[model samples]
Every structure is written in C-alpha cells, then in structure tokens.
Target: MADSTPLLSDSESDKPPEPKRPPRSLDETIERCIGGFGWLQIFQAILVSLAWVFDAQQTFISVFTDAEPSWHCADESVCSSFSNICQLPKGSWSWDWPAHTSIISEWGHQCSTSFITGLPASSFFMGCLVGGLVLATLADSTLGRKNMLLFSCLTMSLSSIFTVFSPNIWIYSALRFMNGFGRATVGTCALVLSTELVGKRWRGQVGVIGFFCFTLGFLSLPVMAYVNRSSSWRTLYLWISVPTILYCILVHFLIPESPRWLFVKGRKEEAVTTLKGLAQTASALTMSFSNVLIEQESLDDNVDIYSSIRILLNKRWAAHRLTAVMVTGFGIGMVYYGMPLGLGNLSVNLYLGVTLNALSELPASLITFFLIGKINRKDSILGFTILSGVCSVLCVVMGRVWPSLQIAMELISFFSACTAFNMTLIYTLELFPTCVRNSALSMVRQALVFGGVFSPLLVAAGRKNNLISFGVFGMAIGICGLPLIGLPETKGGVICDTMDEEEHRQTEKGSAAIPTLA
Candidate 1:
C-alpha cells in the first residue's frame, strides 16, 4: 500500500542487526538452549538420570554386602548341634545358631559373596569399553540416538533382571557385562542427541547439563546403598533393577529419534516432520518456516572407517589426543575407582565418603559452566589438571603424616579429579569436528578404559607403598597439564562442522601476525 518493497529494502539496508543478548531468565535460557525438547524431554532426562543411579547402585551394592554381618558356628557348637542347627562333620552351615556367633560369624564367613559381587561390577565396565567403540559409532550411521538409547535401556534392563535371578557369581558377572554393554550406549548417544537438538550457542551448556545428570546418578548411589545396607545383596540388586526396567519402557515410548541423524541418513521427510513436531511442542515462535526445506549436499559416503584414527595420528591432533587420553584416563581412573578403594582401606564410612565425593561434582559442573565461556579451554583444563595433581600430592603427604587425615585427603582428591575429568570431557568434545565427533569421543573413552585397567594395578601396588602410587598419579596429572600449552583455545569459536573448516581456521590463526594460543 505504501511502496512496501522499496520500504522493506531501504529498512533492511539502513538498520543494523541486534547483538545477541545473554538470557535473563534461567528457565527461558535453558529452554532457548535446549530447543524444542519441552517438558517430556526433561522428564525423559530425569528418567535417564535415575537409570544411571540404578546402574551405579547395582555396582556399589557390593561394598555394603562386603561389610554385612555373617553367621559362623564355634567348634563346640558344631560338635553338639547337628541337623538344622549346624552340621559338625559335613561342614554345612545354616541360618540359625547362637545370636552373636550365628549372625556375626556365619555371616562373616559368607563375606566372599561380597568379593564375588565385585566381579559383575568389573565386567560391567568391561562391557562399556567394548560397547562405546562398537555401538556408539552407530549413533551417527545406521542407528539414530533414540533407537540406540532404547536398545541400550532394553538390554540393560534385561541384564539387570537376569542379574537379580543369577544363580551364582558367574551368571551375575555375565549379565552385568551385558548390562555394561548397554550402559555404554547411553552417555554417547545422550550427548549426541542433546547437541543435535540445540543450536551452537548452547551446545556446551547442554553437554555440561547432560554430564550433570550423570553426576546426580553418582550422588544418588550412596543413598541407595545406605537404605539397602541391612537387606540381602540380592534384594539390593532387585531394588535397583525394577526402576531401570520401568525407565527403559518410558524411554521406548516417550523419546523421539534424533532429527539430525535422520537428516544425515537421508530420511528428509522424517526429519522435517520431527522438527515440525518439536517446534509445535516448544511453542517456538521465531522458527524460519520457509527455510524448513531439506537441502541435501554431497556427503562423503565413502569416508574411511579409520578416518578418525588417521586424524588422531596427525601431528596437530596427535598431541591433543595424547594429552586428553593421559589426563582423562588418569583422572577418571583415580576419581571413580580409587576413592571407594581408598575409603575401604582407611576404615572410613564408604557410603558417606562416596556420597561426599559425588556431591562435589555439582560445584565442579558449576565451575566448568561458568569458566568454559569466559576462559580459554586450554587454561581451564590445565588449571584443573594442576589442581588435581596438587591434591594427589597432598594426599600422599597427609596420609603419611596423619592417618586421620586420609578421609579428608580422599575427599579433596576426589573433588580435584572429578573437576579435571569433567574439563577433559568438554575439551575432547570441543577438539574434533562434528563429522568424527563420535569416533573421537570413542577414542578418548578407550583411553579411559585403558586407564581403568591400570588403576587396579596401581591400587594393588599402592597397598605396598601408598605414597608411591599417589605420587606417581600426581606427577602424571602435572606433566599432562604441561603439554596443553601447545593446544589451541576454542572458547567462543564456532564449532567446526568439517575438517576443512578446522584446517582453515588453523591456517588463518597461523598466518596472523599475533601468536594466538591464549
């Protein structure tokens, strides 16, 4: 009516675009960051979080079982009491006997069950080791995140059920291993799913929030252990299993397939429909509806399976890879496995100590979230690594000087290690392009497993010379931090979608007159 085309052109040319502002309301910010997931997704995230709690509960029930009372008959009672009470010559023991002797002694004799319980725990991690590399890669290819998550949950639930019915330690361990295989799929897929849903501005926050859920799982373990302490280990296993099975069913129905993965696989209509549904759910107002067209670009369908491997071997990536592996491997290996074992040695309240250790993760997550946006990635990583290393050294020195301080030292060490571990995960995710993100993450996961394997040996060796193991662990953390000087800072940078973009950024940085490591 009023020269609309000319007015629009003139207005567009004259007005400058508004600068992106930080969100004022936390809820609005989170919604903006998470995009389109809505209340159902939050509920799903909670369910997934609880599933992880059960996962840890299943593994940690052993510690409570190990410390439970057992029944044992005295030699005199064995000779006198025969039949149901006690069998003298046959060496058979029953539940009934003298109050103190039967409950405490006989129960103590069955303490080997606790050790046997640990076999499944180890097997679960081993399963994670295998599944992370094998099943996680499928997140990008054949299986989308939703399907993979459902499969993992289903298998893990089945394994948990089987574990509850396990006739012996071997069956329990095998089922736990199977469960671990499924558990391995959860973290990676959850990560990919969260990242795909969000825009670039909020990827880090979403990643950290996902890890926060994991930390919640860790924190909840001690509560479960404390509640189930008086119950039979089998009962404890059953308690943990039921919730996970229910969660699996919920996930199967409620969670949708990742639209990005659908797009990648050339399921354009499905992806478009899914996006539309998400928009409807979020009540998102500013979506570019006209731009909803599915544009297919030429993708490298023939990409080498070993492509990530080659990149990791390259000079630029190799250094970061080695640093990430060594630091993360050591940090997670110590923080997760070492804390419980160390607490067991100190005769401290294992559940309390573990809970405290897990609770420390909240602050760590907060620290990373605050600092990741402001500071350089390399500095944040290096700073945390040094902090952990210093704590490790303190653990050694303090453990020798005052045995009472061992508990305190363990707490400090756990906090430091967890902070470093969280940083390493974020840094590793930041280092790679989207095309090979899963593969690169898998490589780092492999390093974590490798570290896990060595952790037991280190703990065993520490039994002989406690100071030595702590010292070695501390030194490793400090040394690993040093190489970070060479690593590039990725804070505030657009996440690279391809290797070419990454290489171009590197070239541009290299050509700049000013040195840019900071």
Candidate 2:
C-alpha cells in the first residue's frame, strides 16, 4: 500500500467518470420499454382479453342448448305437473315448446339414459383434456402465444358454426368435441398473452380484464337465450360463432405478438421493435436493446413442441408447484363449471337463476382487480374454497327446511368459487418462469376440464338428489385448496423471464438460509 493514492496521472483523473450500465435482464428491459401502464397497454390488453368473451360463450353455451325444455300434460287425466314424462304415455305428455328448441328435445334424448344426455358435455370436456395435453406445449414452443391464440380461436369459431348443421346427437356430440378441442387454449393463451403484453406492475390487473370480459360473455348468454327462448338452439351457435369469426379477423389484423416470446425464441430484433412500438416516451424509444444480456438457455432458436413441458417435468420445485395448482384448479373447476349447468335442477326460473349466477361473477372480477396487490394468492384461494364449500353444503342442508334460501346460498358459493378460479389462474401464471409458463398454465386448465368432464354426469344424476352435484362440489374445492400450504407465496415479487434466472434466485435464497459455524 506504499503508493495507493498516487497511481493515476493528473490527466487520467481529469476525465469524466464512465456511466453505469442499466440492468440487462429481460424483465427490467421490458419495464423500461413499457414505461407505465398507459392507454396503449390498456388497448392491447382489451383486444387480447376479448378472446375470453368468446371462450366463455363456448364454455356455457351448452347449458341452454342442451337443456330439456318444460313438458306439459296433453291428457289431464293421464298426466299431471309432477308426473315423470319418461314413464308417462308419450301421447299423454308433450314438450311445452317445439322439439327444435333444445338438443335434448330435438334429438329425442329426453327419455334416454343419463349417459346419453350427458355425453355431449362430457365429450366436450374430454376433448379439452386431450387437446390440452396435445396442444399445450405448442404455445411455449414453435407456435408462440399470438399464433396459437389465433389458430385456436379460429378453429373454435369455425367448429361452432358447423355445429349448427348437425343432423343427430352423434354428429352434435362429435362437433362439440371438436369445438372443445379448439377452445382448449383460448382462455390460457388470452390470459398469458394479455399479461405478457404489460409490465409487471399491471400484469395482475390486465389478467383480470379477461375475467371481466368472460363475465360479460356469461351475462350475454342468459339475455340471448331469453331473447331466443322460443327460437331454435342452433341460432345461438350462429349468433356466437359469426361474431367470434369477426373477432378473429380483428385479432389477426390488430394484435402484435408477445415481445417476451420473440426474445426467448431467439428473435431478438423483432422483440426490440415490438418493445419500441409499445414505448410511449421518446427516451424509452431511444434506449438501446443491443446490450441486453439474457441467459443463453432462454434463447431456444428451434424449441421443440414438447421441450417446454419436458423442462417443467425435469425441475423438482416446478413439478411440485404444478401438481399443487392443478389439484386446486380441479376443485374450483367442478363448482365453477357445474353450478351453472345444474341450474335447471333448482326450483327457481332457469333463465333468472342463470342470470343471478352470471351476475355473481361481477363483484368477483371487480374485487380481484381492485385488490389484486393486497391479496395473498395462496391464503385467498384457501379461504374462498372453504367459504364456497360451506355455502354449497348449506344449500343442500337449508333447501330441506327453507327452499328460498337455497338460491341465495348457491349464489354465494358460486361467487366464492369464481373468485378462487380467477386467483388460481393468476397464481399459476406467477408460479413459473416465462419459458414454461404457458405449458404450466395449460396443464392447470386441463386439470380444470378434467374435473368438468364428470360435471355433466354429476349434474344429470343430481336431478333426483342434490347431494351428488353440490355436495361433491363442496368437498372437492375444500380439499383441493389444502395443498397450497406447501407452496411459496409470490405476492409483490418480481417475475422471472428465464429458467436459469429463477433457479439462480432460488439457489441464492437457499444459500442465504445456512448460518456460519464460527
């Protein structure tokens, strides 16, 4: 240390200090480019979120289309209001409406076994399950979010239009399968794409926009079904499909691909241009993307279709998180999907009941949007599930003594389930890094549809007994939310863009926990 202060010359010391470099991580770069949650980001999120509207339309459309219309006594002496139409003489009892109004009446499935009546709904969910498994990784790999969203939406819309021409139950069921297969990725892609378009500060809020759009779609169904109460069920398909096709056209023309996806796919230049276009300020536009230093593993130039899924499976922590979320989603999905479909069994007016159930989702979406930052994802989900379960079981218990109290309890139960459903998706989104985010989300949705597969059968059997549908729904959601205890909380945390980055973070945190032996 003899000459420590005399090393530099006077001329060298006179030069200005070098500027410090900005963070090169993709997350930071994205935040810099986005600048703030501006109108551009809001518009982009709305355009992408509109997909969930059509998705919701397709998901609950069957509730009205497949419903069995009211029946009446053709011969007063032979049949009464309480008589079983299946056992009553065919001529003595006739449907209150024309046969063409519902699939159950049109296809002569009213008196058929429950298995036959539940087939179309079950098949649709099964298609979702299979399609999710087959198409899940494509978004994370070659197709990317925008293309996958476009393809899946277009396919779903076209199939829905074709469903209008079905001649029999077999053909209708087959077409429903195709529709479900196509619609499998709609919500997943839309949620992921919309959130990815925004900065971390707005991701959760942006994601909730999709749920609101979905609610609008759900709300629209009851109105449309009421308007077409006496019209053919096929008309509903056309009404939803034509508008969806137009939406697909708009998406194709207006939406930009996700910048994060482009960068990870080794298309850096496109990512930079996309980021620049999203930037509102002149300074952000001028900021160079040249020195951004993402991990090499994130740049997969030729990522295989199954590569993202394989990556998720290979990681121990990722697998555990995936399993936990999926189990929780299954519970939420059963009640979320089943409750509306089973509305016919309730004593209230079908359309009014459906409207009430649809309206219950409004506060859920608003609550999620307004309090997204304050809510703890894991704890909220657990609490909602327990509340939903309690309300659901009470619906059954209270229905015996106070019949009017049943719908109110059911509404609360469904509302709780809806809140839990929204949080589950957003929570799953944050649980994984960007590289395998879509694949993980798709798997969770498949678990959701897997639970829905049994919904129709349960709803059908529950016609005679409420215990089968509502009772099981209560238990499933209550138990499924328990696994969240073992998972880590992600509230107020920065999301990672790469597997290597996330791994390094976890490793460092683990290392920090070890105390010195001194």
Candidate 3:
C-alpha cells in the first residue's frame, strides 16, 4: 500500500526482456504444423496403425482359433501323446463338444474349446485397465511418447512370442495378460504422441486417424487367421508377433519424442531440435526454425495431480465425463464383446461372425470421418447410440419371432454399434482441454476397461436366458446417450490449449464460472 506504483515500475524495469512470442492463431498453428511435419506425421500414423492392427489381431484370435475344429481321440493317452501331431483330416476337426450333424441348426454344438482356450482373454483387458490408468500418466511427464512407444512395442512383441510357446492354457493366459498390459501402454502413448505433435486445430482428425489404425488391425486379423488356419494355434501367435518386433526396431531409429511434452518439461532446446528434425523429414522448405520458439503459458501455482483430477470433474466437465463413461462402457462392452460370444453360442462359424463384426468397423470409422466435420459431435453420438440400441432391441425381437433372421439382426446391430464405438473414441478426445487432456482421456479409458471386464460375463449369462441380456444392454446404451443432451457440441471446434482458455470460453458461453489463469 505504501508507494506501490514506484515499486512496480522498478520491478518492471529490472525484469529480464521477454522472449518473442510465436503466432497463436488457430489457422497459423495448423498451417505451421502441417507445413512442418505433414509427411513424417503420416509415417508415424502408419506405424501406430500397425500397432493397433496387431492389438486387434491378438484380441480376436480366440474367435478364429475356436472356429477351427479340434479332434479328441477316444483314448486319453493317445490324445495326450498325439496332441501336437498335425494329422487330423483337413477341415474335419470340430472343437465343438457333442458335435451336431447340422451346422446351421439353432442348437448346433457350442465351441467350448474356444472358450476354454480363450478364458485367459480377460487377463489382457485387466492388465490394460490397471496399466493404462497408472502408467499412462507418466507418458507426458517423464518417459515421453517416443520412449513409451518403443518400450510398449518391445514388451508386447516379446510377450506375444512367449504366448505362442505357452505349454498350457494357464501359461498362455498369463502371457497374454502381459501382452495386454504392453498394448495398453501403446494405445495411450500413441494417442498422446500424435496429439502433441499437432496444434489444437488438428487434434480431432489426428485422434480419429489413431483409432482408424485400430480398425486396420481388425482387418488384418482375418488374413492372419486364414493364413495360419492349418498350423497350430501357437504358430499363429508366433507369426503375428514377428512383424511387430521388426517395427519396434524401426521405431527406435525413426520416431522423435513429442515436442509438446518437451516444451512442457522446460526442455526448449530439445523441442526445437525435434521440430526441426520433423521439418527436415517432411521436406518442409518454408519452416523458419528461429521463429518457432515455444511460447510459455502461465499456469496455476497449485498445479498437481489432484488439481488435474479436480479440473476434469469440475461442473463444466461433469456432463462430459459422465457421457464418456456411460457411452464407452455400454457401447463397447455390449456390442463389441457381447456379439461375438453370443454368436458363438448359436453357431460354429464364430470366425464368420467375428469377421462380419470387424468389417462393420470400417464403415463406422469412415462414417465418423465424413460426418465428424459435418454434424455436431453430441448429436452424432446420440444418433448412433440410439441407432445401435434400437438395432439391439430389434435383434431380441428377431431372435424370438423369426429365429432364421438372427444372423441378419446380429450383423445389422453390429454395424450400428461399431459406429457408436468408433465415435466414442473420437468424441472423448474432443471433450477435454490440453492441460489435463491425457488424464481425462485415461479416466474415460478406465471406464471402457471396466465395461470390457463385464462384457464376457454378460454374454455368458445371456447364453442361458434368451433376450434378457440384450434388452438390458440395449437399455444401458440408450440411457447413456441421454447425457449427451447436456454436453456442449464440439464438432469442428478447435481444442483449447490450456485450462484457463477453456474456462474463459465456458464462462463467455454462460456454461460455468471457473477461475481463470493469471
């Protein structure tokens, strides 16, 4: 209070000269990022795409493995001794217990061997649930995206190979769990990496591209399954792991650490060097390295892990968090996991069902790409969730009245549900600001894993009671979309770079009144 003006003037005079700021307009940032790292970004995208493809291949292998018929000898000793011998007649082996003469009959033999073989499948998602939530937070703060990707790739590849040699189901499941933990690391790290490389304008598109690669993985699984159909299941695991291991080697030499993470950690020189390397790889001639200094934004002094959690749970984001949990949990849990298990109960061609389901994801992703720019995200999500729920309810009706239409109903429901699943992935990324983006995303992913955990159990329970499981699932899916009504529309909206800006915008829109940064 005493001579405050003089003291302020003196402090201002003594302060070090401020560094020049780079351009911050949305368009300029987008243009600079595209102009600088466009081609290399595409390469990075492809590598990430392959990683996801392998992940899907690993997940759905159980379906194809179960579809293949197995031979059980009458003599226990013969069965035990000759199990590794590949002498069964081509296409005659059936893993279904109490084999049925009519493959198309509604009461056709359930492939119990696949269930037994795949019992360990849940372990992977369990590992993913734990690892993604806990280890993923370090991706931004300590390890950085590049090293995380490299480590995940190495771990998953080695584990996949180890799974192939698993002496029994118990050993195999344990190995698969390890593989899943590594895969989760890849999923979270890759998304964080891609988003960090671009400015706010391209975050949605890049996130879509990241999920798109996962669908590509689904597509690749069928080809891999078909190729290894004659070989032992262990051989199939080995073949899939090989290419991923090779890619890991390539990642070490090619990918750079995320520049955004570098800037945030006060490693300005490293960030500039990495950006320049990307520009060189992209052959960008117009980029001015000297003009690309990272501009530091003032953040709250109390920033910590707990503060980030509070930010995501604040009044402004509560609806978004709720929508993410409900939609992702129910959509993927019911549709993606439920359909395959249910179909296996009714038919021997579980691979056919899985392939059809995977195929549906392609159109879903394409639709998301086309409509994400055209439609409001909230509306699109609600529309697709409603469509999927209706389709699921229809399946229940079709299964009862016209049992012959069960396959058709399943295929249709899968198509609609997959669209919702893909959109959930895209929309969740769009909902949060950058300051706590990874944390918020990890929270949503944890919900997805929670949902995934319940899917197999629900499908198994549904096999005993017709329509009960699906009706409950449909209700859950439809009800989840109700929260979308409260979420702000984010389609084509530029992502906010910091919490303060997000709060300011929310206040301007009369949504909420959060504290702004100094």
Candidate 4:
C-alpha cells in the first residue's frame, strides 16, 4: 500500500493543474463592484432605449402618413362641412386633404389607384426582411452591438430625412423601404446591448424600459398627428428624423460596446477598460479588477460571423426552437402591425382611434414589466396569445351588432397582443447564448416583419370584410400556438454557451425544457 501510494503521488504530480474559474461571473462582478441596479447601468440602458422610441414611431408612422384622406363629391360643391363624404357616390368625391399631406391623397388614388397605396407599407416590411437576413450577423461578429445600432439608427434617420424630399409615391415608397432596411437591427441591437450591460438581477427591469419607451413613442404619435393634422405629412417625417439623427451621435459618444460581446470575441483588454469605466462611474474605491480579465466565461460564441446562423441551424434542438418561435412571432406580427391600419373600418374618429390604440400599449407595457419576473415565460406567451386571439375573433363577430362594443373589444385585443409581443421578446432573449443572441432575435423579428408585409395588403383589400382583417390575425395567433406545446418552459435555467451544453440541458430538464436566462 505504501509503494502504491508513492506511485499515485508521482502520477498526481505529472497531471496538469486544473484551470481556474472566474472569481465571479461578469453579471456578478458588475453588481458587486458597481452596485446592483447602479445609476451607471440605468443611464446606459436608458440611452440604448432611446432607439426603441424612434423605432416605434417610424414603424407606425405609415398609418398616419399613408392613410386615405376624407373626401366629398367634386360635383357636390354644395355639400357643407356637416356631411359624411363617404355617403356620397364614390366616383364624384375628391380628396379633402392636400396632395402633400398623404400619398394616397396626392396621387389621386380612387378605386383605380387604391392598390398602389398599400405598396409602400408592404415595401417597408420587405426591406426589413432583406436587412435582417443581411445585417443580423454583423452584430454577433465584428461590428458588435453598439456599432450596428449606431449604424442602423444613422441609416434609418438619414433615410427618413431623404423621404421628406421624395418626388412621387414610387420614390417615397422606395425610401420607406430603405428606412425599413436601416431600422431593422435597431430594436434587436438595442435590447441585447442594454440588457447585457446590467446584472441578471436587474435584467428584467432594464429590459422593460425598452418596451416602455416603445409605448411612449406609440402614445406620442397620436399627439403629433393631432398637432400636425393640417400640415403636410412631410413635416411629420422631418420632425421625427432630426432627433434620431442627433440620438445617433449621442449613442456613439455615450454607449460602450457590450462587454459580454467583447469577451466572446476574445477582446479582454477592451472588456477590462469597459468594466473599469463602470467602476469609475460608481466611484469604486478599488480598480484592481484584474479578475475581470482572468477567465472569460465561455469560448463557444461564433468567431465566424458569416456562419452564425449555420451554427445555430446545424444544431437540431436549436433549429426546432427557432422554427417554433419564428412561426409564432409571425402570427403576432400580423396582428400588431395590422390593427392601426384597420381601425378606420370602425367608423370612429381617426385621431381618437389612434390615441386609444396607442394608449393600450401603456397597460401592456406595465403588465408585461410586472408579470414577466414572476410567471413562466411559456405560460405568459401561450396564455396571452390565446386571450388576444379571442378578443380579435370577438371584434369581427360584434363589429356590426354593437359597433362601440366592437371598438372596445378590438382595443382589448390590441392591448393583449402588445403584451404578448413584449413577453415573446423577453422569452426570445433567453433562448440562445450570448454568441448568437442578437442574430437569433434579429431573425425572429424579421419573421414578424414578414407577417407585417401581408397586413397592409389585407387591410386595403378587405376593408369591408372584418373577418379578413381581424379573423385571420386571430386564427393565426391562436392556432399557431399549438407548436408551443412541444417547447419546454424556460423560466429558471442557465443559458447554454454551446449546442452540446444546451442539448444536455434539455435532457436534464426532462426533454421539454427550453433555454433560459440565468
């Protein structure tokens, strides 16, 4: 036994030293050094969230800008200010709005030109599709989150600026498409960057701020539209664009590259500098934070930016999860984007309708911010989707029998849909690791845009048929949720850094497990 013990000691001496783990995770280190929910973190998140505001405004601006104007019969010049122009014969009516106010009004779009009016909205969504396919990878790779966000914001703002000068609807539609292309990465990049900047304990709180900003932007639209009701729509574009252009400059100066992403790319020195800045901001007494550089959490992030999606899709479970989330997101996207465009069928005040619809986002944001921390993400997504779907179906059934009741129900559905959208985004953030998080989200959001591409066409073609507008949205969201049954609950699990780790994680959680944020 003594001889054997010496042999064991010799063998042990020859073994390599076990690699040391990081003293604490980046999230933990940030919290301990900078204080949990620190002002520095909050300020960074708020700055990043400004992008959401501009994104939301530009996304829904078309509802006001492209809307068909009120009109009266040209022959019936005797018609006073008191009558409904829609009641008169369609062919005799000319637009009440000036050519510069709305493209539909400027181009003399009656029945003959009605189809072209939907083109701009569709074109914008199509641009989103193309951009997501193209630009999503840059954030995960060389450009990083801050750079991609700044670029997207700059491009989107510049596109909006140029849109104000378009000579015709065709040029205007083309510019809007370019704007969509530029804006495609803004929400994804902003959300990922801002959330990663904070500790896990504060991630939910910080994430909700983006949604709140989006809701604020939505609310602002009605007020802006009302204030500019008599002015050219071009003026609205110009007003919104200038601030965003300035925001791009602020982001460049203020927002740092995501430290998490820097570590993923093996840029440890930069990560050290970023953390040092955070410590300095919090007035940390000790800046000897060499532990931040000692051990990076994982090296599984995509070094090959071009094949990030391939890395994601090549994994079986990942492919399945992505497929399901994207399909469901498409359904949600259709409803979220469709409601504003379809509101005119309710025969309510356009301004009031927009205000009410926009107002719904407030409660949606509050409810989402409140419950997401408590409930399971799957339960929240599945339950809210069902509720929103029911409300939409009711809108169609009760639209004629009780018009006022129908509007109320539609608003409820819109609010519910917004809540579902918020939950889905939060849930999506947990589904992938830091390596592919931005890319996955970018692609999923593009699925929403793909669904949105069809919404404007449907709203225009099915103006009289409430079922085509509301019913399709309801059915798609309600039924598409079936696939979610196969997806696991991802409420309290660690995010997997590699496909193998994630697959094993799914097994340990009993096969129905979904990815989760830690």
lDDT of 3 by residue, 180-296 (tens): 788776766677777667755556667677667777777777677666565566677777789888988877787778766565555656766776666633434456555555444
Q: In candidate 1, what residue range of length 10 has the lowest lDDT sum?
A: 22-31
Per-residue lDDT of model 4, residues 126-184, tens digit only: 88888888999899988999999999999999999999998888898899999999999
RMSD of each: 8.4, 4.6, 7.5, 3.8
Is 3 or 4 the stronger prediction by TM-score?
4
When summed lDDT is taken over every stretch of 10 residues in candidate 3, the lowest stretch is 100-109
In model 4, the runs with Cα more than 4 Å from the true position are 1-25, 74-94, 280-287, 297-302, 496-511, 514-518
lDDT of 2 by residue, 37-85 (tens): 8788899899999999999999999889998898888898877754678
Ranking by TM-score: 2, 4, 3, 1
Which ten contiguous residues of candidate 2 have the minimum total lDDT? Answer: 509-518
Clash list (residue pairs), candidate 4:
488-512
For residues 1-518, what per-residue lDDT tens digits would candidate 1 score against the true structure? Answer: 57555646776888898875421221232233346546655554444444445544554454554342333454555545543332344454534333222112323334353335345556767887887767756655566677777687677767777766665557666877787787776666666666555555656766677657767767776776567555446565566667777876776776667655554455656755666655533345455433443233322333344544555556355445555555555555554555565555454566677777778878887877676677776677677767777777787777778877766766766676666766776676767665566666666666655555455456546765766567666776666567556566677765554555456566767833114322
Ranking according to lDDT, highest score first: 2, 4, 3, 1
TM-score of each: 0.76, 0.93, 0.79, 0.91
Question: 2 or 3: which has the higher lDDT?
Answer: 2
lDDT of each: 0.59, 0.87, 0.63, 0.80
